[model samples]
Target chain A: MRRALTLVVSGMVAALLGILALGGLSAAATATDKEAANEAKSVSEAAKRAGKKDPYAPVVYGDR
Target chain B: MVEQTTGVGAPPVRRVRDALPLYAVAAAVTVLVLAPLAAPGYALLYDMVFVPRQPLSWDLVAPAQTLPRAVPMDALMSLVTQLVPGWAVQRVALGGAVLLAAVGAGRLVPTERLAVRLLAAVAYAWTPYLAERLLIGQWGLLLAYAALPWLVRAALDLRAGRDGALARVVLAAAPAAITPTGGLIALGTVVLLVWDRTRLRRSALVVGGVALLNAPWVTAALVTGAGGSSDPAGVAAFAARSENWAGPLVALAGTGGVWSAQATPSSRAAPLVPLATLLLLILAGVGAGLLRRRLPPGTAVRLAVLAGIACLLAALGVLPGGAAALRWAVVHLPGAGLLRDGQKFLAPYALLLVVCAALGAERLVARIDREVAGVVLVGLLLLPVAVMPDLAFGGAGRLRPVSYPADWQVVAERVAGEPGEILALPLSAYQAYPWNPGRVVLDPLPRYLPGTVLTDDTLRVGDVAVAGENPRLREVRRVLAEGLPVSATGVRWVVVQHQLPSEVDPATLRDLEAVHEGPFLTLYRNPAVPPESNPPGLGAWAVVMALGAALLVVMAAAISALHRRPTAW
Candidate 1:
């Protein structure tokens, strides 16, 4: 029983952490997050105006 | 073959309970002794280095799918700071480290006498190496240091074929999730566990338990290509050098000698103070030798040999052959980069020295009355504190924390409504904020701003030779040096300091509009950009691995419980 319980508890904690990460559950970014996001968006928009493609898309590094 | 005489004969849980009062006193004294770290609203030296801007969420965990350093320790610290103020969290965390060290020392030392155990606990908690590390602001490494004694105790229990050894080892191995040093110590404990061939199966279970506890960080490092460094210059700079053999020796006696920031050179007495301090420790060590007969012969010899070997390895850089050997291994082997800070090896040596010193002092005062013996024991306990007054109430030579500038808060509010990543110029990680004169601190920008803003000012890894590899980091640097690039790097806002770089042409920024202008900061926004929608490709893989890791931990825990012995000895 003790061994079984230990397994259950460990499994639950690990699964919970995994779920948290996998769910992409944004626990609501503060005012600061909104500002930082907006700022980056603004820069991407400027890039678009300068004829850049998909300026608002995620910046993927090819080397990574 | 041998009857247990280390007082570890009793079940560990019972032994720990019996010593609860002593542990409490040790913890209380630790907090009192290091009161300066917990001063109201004043942050410790490196609190800002680890403080994340936003609270710890699922996003902090690294696994190639998330940001780097998804280690539990970082996440734990970030989570705590979100609820508690940063300065208070730093103080409590530091205080908790000393308390943990005290408890581990109390539990590990085999002495039966309460006074002797308590004295050893104090010695282990208040050593020169502890002070030097604290002053150097390596709290993550210090967490591992605090956990070393618990590892030793758990290892010994496993060797004795005691019940619940696997459980204890798992509990003690918690530090590994935060710092690799803890993982290294956990490895040593595994070697000790497996040393008893008859108990090989049980020991393997303990190893599995440790691996499970460390899965989050270990998995992250393996998956993310995060660990390893081959920088020769960093190796030279951080490696334990034998150039001054006496430096580490004196440090073991509670005098400072690692980095310039941690080094303490007395002016009035000059060399005499350090020499005298060394002599005093040597005298205590000699006393310990006289009482060596009291220790179980096997345990005493093993600890002594271990201490000697650690001391040798810590000072290996003194010789040309040793230096070459370390350099070779660092370049050829993976994970050997951690040995660059070779002084960390002294953690175990210091533990052994304090235990032995306590035993020696116990014998020396054996004949005295209880009151006088108590006084002598307390004096012995305070010896390290007396030798290093700077780490005591003096706040470790740091002053009170200064509040952030009002302009920063105002700018943060103005930028909150914007979306996408933001960049701050001039991009630097560690800065000497004019508001807090005379102290260097991690840049407060990340803490004040929200969401994934990018800055390369802080070295992600400490003093490692790996050059900055991220093209994004390079593009950001270029954008800072030259004006905003012809192509966008997905940065929506550019926050330029009051004094812009000479090469940066404001006119070159297309569709740029000034949102907020201040004496200290100017915020520019590109109105043409929209909010980011696409997620990274690895996000799904990360979630899957995370769930797999959870299952692995469950299996390991079950194995540990299967090996558990009945409570009755």
Candidate 2:
């Protein structure tokens, strides 16, 4: 019964969780347009501190 | 009788009652599989479309999703998409699992009806695949695994009442028609059934059934490019991508992504999985030994052995102790030949071992640890999950935010300031367009670019022979002269990712154009474009995708509620 309840409640929670996930995501999606100056500043500072690991890091043949 | 309906439509009442549990399980699986769409990257579809065929060409055509050996099961999805109106092929894979799992559980413990139903839910709920967090985006694997329990159940069904030879043959052969791995699993299982029973006729029939089912896919592969068409050297190079023994297993066990190294606590727990897996293997061996004398005649011992072999194969690439084993058998195993990242075989290995270990735990639960059954059984079941990094549950998904690479908005904003057509390289996060109905030379994609050669090894710029050699300069010159380059035909801003290293300079080659720079990418102007030429802003496909998705959700919900459930079965 507990297992069954876990499945059921977990399922319900998954559904409820879906709303949160959706809200969190879509909010972020539009918020993407609202580029905070602070984020840019932090990103620039961090780039200087650490190396720039651009998203597309190709597999350098020799590096591999 | 129980209102028997036949031929084209809804199954009879008795059949419905018998399969009710499967129905619930199927529904749950369908939900979980499609749920990834709510996340970014449309990751479920993206993985399905791209990972199998990484490194895009200028045209960005999606041929890799269906190329090469043509996994029989995934090919069936192309047919499913073609024949079955309005069905997303990915969901069908999950449906297949839910279906077979239903049958398998139904057959194994029919008396435990509620338990069977619950297990079906837990099957998805707690599966390593479920927790792996990444979508089980492989349509072929889904189809292949789905057919498993059905085959197993059919074997058990043969043991029961009426002669079930034909059904067993069909079920056993079904996997062979799906994915090769799945087909292998099916063939192996059928071989076990036959070897144990000494039933040559049965074995032949099952094998024949699979061959018959796969006839079209095999023919198609031959026509396009079968395994023969594969670049032996290229494939070798790809498969040559080496990983540690534990990599695949660690990744697979981390199915939920909770146990991922990126997850906060992953490093602490990751090293322990090999130990747990080893313990489970020993337990499986002991379980087999203890039950050897009291087995279910032929099939039991044979199946247990086959399952053992499958586990050994997966572990050879995963377990720390398997180094000696992998070295000894590396030449003889098919994994050495075809299985790249022998670690990917980890997921399959985990499934096999978990099942075997579950059987062991089942025995232990019954005989010695009935009092601590929950502790011991759940512990054994969770060893892989706990050790896995992906299974971390951060409230719901990940605790940290996942950012799409080269944020589209930033790219678009940079383009707005430019006075020419914006041609961009392939964004790592999403597919670029070619048809924005605008002057963006490389719409979102550039398949329209001629001589967009794709070879066996490198994905894009297949024309380039090793990176250092400068044949690419000639190709680029040719491309610049041709329609493939955005700047070739009067587009000013030639935007490319700075990360994509090319030996040639954008300014030096063309001898013309001013350049605008974005924080992420560089935009070069085509001096050829007459003054005051400006391409329209980025096109509206993302909007189209958004609208199409909203409509699909409504359609799916409506279909779920209004469509008569009986017709679906």
Candidate 3:
């Protein structure tokens, strides 16, 4: 009975830890996503204003 | 798999656990080298065209059939992008490649000591070819490069009749998920297998396995009629042009390829020869000399011959008689166009050199005291990073990725439900984006608008253009020369990229209505358009691929299970 109790508690603890770890990972990923979104918006606005040709396009290769 | 020592001075890898530390170090270094990728908002400059905004689909894999180059990696990336953000996927993939190459190279080394294997891995994974290609954005080819060591190890293991060798071969062939280079390597491996008559059964199995792995791309190429013509200038453009007769030699030693000035690293550790690269060259020479005494005579000879052939091929453009030979081969041969960039063949040569250096390092340790050997090995391993710091993470200066304009996102969103084909205007294959100065980004329009079939046939290779028929080309030309007339052209929507050079003024179109107008792009809609037709048998092809991939995974899992059983090993 005592051994069973110990096993059950340990299993619960392990599950809890796993969930916490996963939550941390997701949190980090979310932060990165938000940052990327903000940067994309900024760059897009800049690109709209600049309106220059794609410098890395294949046509440029022909020129080179 | 059981470790079998076929050649002299061979030390067995006791267990898989013994390889873990080296792999860990490799993983850490890989992460370090690509640290810039971990940065927020950065996207790779290369083919982000298929960066997944929506769920993965048949459209993602179908392009392999029609595209000239079968880049299975793009499909894989698309699948990955479904879960991970697009900005992070390239960095993760490249880091994974570096780790894979390191582990694979470590396994190929026949040395007893762990240090030698680790050092060899560093040499193999951190070559000038790797840096140059990564900088140029040929990650698919690099995936194949990373798998080369594993392929060799598996081939050697199979020859020895080691259990689970077939499984290793299957795993190594996984790189076929990215590039057709694995198939090419497998072909060479089969040739090697042919040399040993006793390994005939294993060789046949290896061939079948390789064929199965390569089926998606191979079938696609066959179905699309992909590889026949060669353009002389196109062939010449990618040919390995050495600076001098010894140019290829110097490049292999340290500097880089002879082709593009951009291949040079952003920063130099030394003006002439990076101290680390020179050390590797010296080590390789020493290793070669020791090969006859330490390793099997035949194996040693084969390694030297392979390296020599690679060097010869790499120098073919710049050498006195080489250009003529290369020209002849390109003109006369059927699939010789694939070898246009002959320098890529040097990857195997680099592999052999690393193995040789590892063996030589082992010999040096045996002769000298531990203290002296330790100093020498550590210095050699660290010198590469010291000499070429930019290669560590910055990709020689192109680490940050620029985002597509929000106009692209908005346009893609607007066309999400459209069924008809959308034609992109200023129909140039490659365009330099002003947003990211001096860097080129492939058309992101198709990537943004997943719902529609985007048509632009400006992609070319020398004089031989891509798979657009004369009639279609004529129609496109006419549409571009004259403004889009709704009834004449079948295109439902015309996307005019105002920033690029275009023959016709999109605003001048009479019948087409301006549906959406933005700063950089203008979308015009046609009133009359036909319904979409299903691509013949493409669904069937997708099913076959799905089944084939599932089968491989099942087989691999079964083999792994069998390997785990005590009696089986």
How does each model score on lDDT? Answer: 0.55, 0.38, 0.59
User: Per-residue CA lDDT of candidate 2, range B1-569, in tens?
Assistant: 01112112455675566566556655544443334333333122212331111212211221221232333333333334445422233334444554554344333322222332333333333444433223323445555555555555455444432254445445445643454455556656655554334556655655555444544333333333112222222222222111224544443433222211211222223465455446666655555543343334554555556655654554444356555444444344423333422322333333333344444555655654333444444344334323432322221232211223343345444444543333444322222221111001112212211112221122221121222112333344456556354455444445555433232344443544435455544545566764443222222222223224323433443454345344544
List the lowest-lDDT window of 10 residues for candidate 2 chain A.
Answer: A55-64
Error of 2 at B414 (Å): 26
CAPRI tier for the interface of model 3: incorrect
Q: Could you tell me the lDDT of residue B329 within candidate 2?
A: 44
Worst 10 residues of 2 chain B by lDDT: B433-442
The interface RMSD values of the models, given in order, are 21.5, 12.2, 14.9
lDDT of residue B553 for candidate 2: 36
Instruction: Give DockQ: model 3.
Output: 0.06
Chain B alone vs. reference chain B, TM-score for every model: 0.78, 0.53, 0.82
Ten-residue stretch with the least lDDT total in model 1 chain B: B260-269
Task: Residues B1-569, candidate 1: write the lDDT tens digits.
Answer: 12122354688787667778767867765764455454445442433354424443333545332223336655566667777776666666677778888877766655667777787777777676776566545676677778778777766766766676656666666664366566656666455433555766776676766666566655555555333434444445554422133454455344234432212212212344465356446745765674466544466666666666667656655445767777877677765656655676677677777776767777767866555566566666655544444444423334244555567666777667655566665554444444444344455565556545555532322222233323466666675467655226557776765432122455655566778787667777756666553353464356446535644664564566566645424
- Model 3 chain B weakest 10-residue run by lDDT: B1-10
Best by lDDT: 3
lDDT of 1 by residue, A1-64 (tens): 6545644554554454344422321211111323434543564466567654322221211000
DockQ of each candidate relative to the true complex: 0.01, 0.06, 0.06
What candidate 2 gets wrong by more than 4 Å, as runs, is: A1-64, B1-34, B38-41, B44-46, B50-67, B71-79, B82-87, B95-136, B155-165, B168-176, B195-199, B216-269, B275-295, B308-337, B343-352, B367-569
Report the C-alpha lDDT of model 3 over B1-569, residue by residue, as the tens digit. Answer: 12223232244453545767787778866875566666565454444343535434444455522333544554566567778876666666677778888888877776667787788777777777777767656677778778877777766666666667667666666663456654565555544532466666766766766666666665555444334445545545655533333455466545356343334453432444444456666777777676556444465565566567666666666568667776677667755655666676677788877877777777766675555566556655665555455566545335455666667776776666665667776666555555554444556665556543454544443333433322454576786568555336677777877665445454556677777888777777777775463454764385347436735753774578477556665
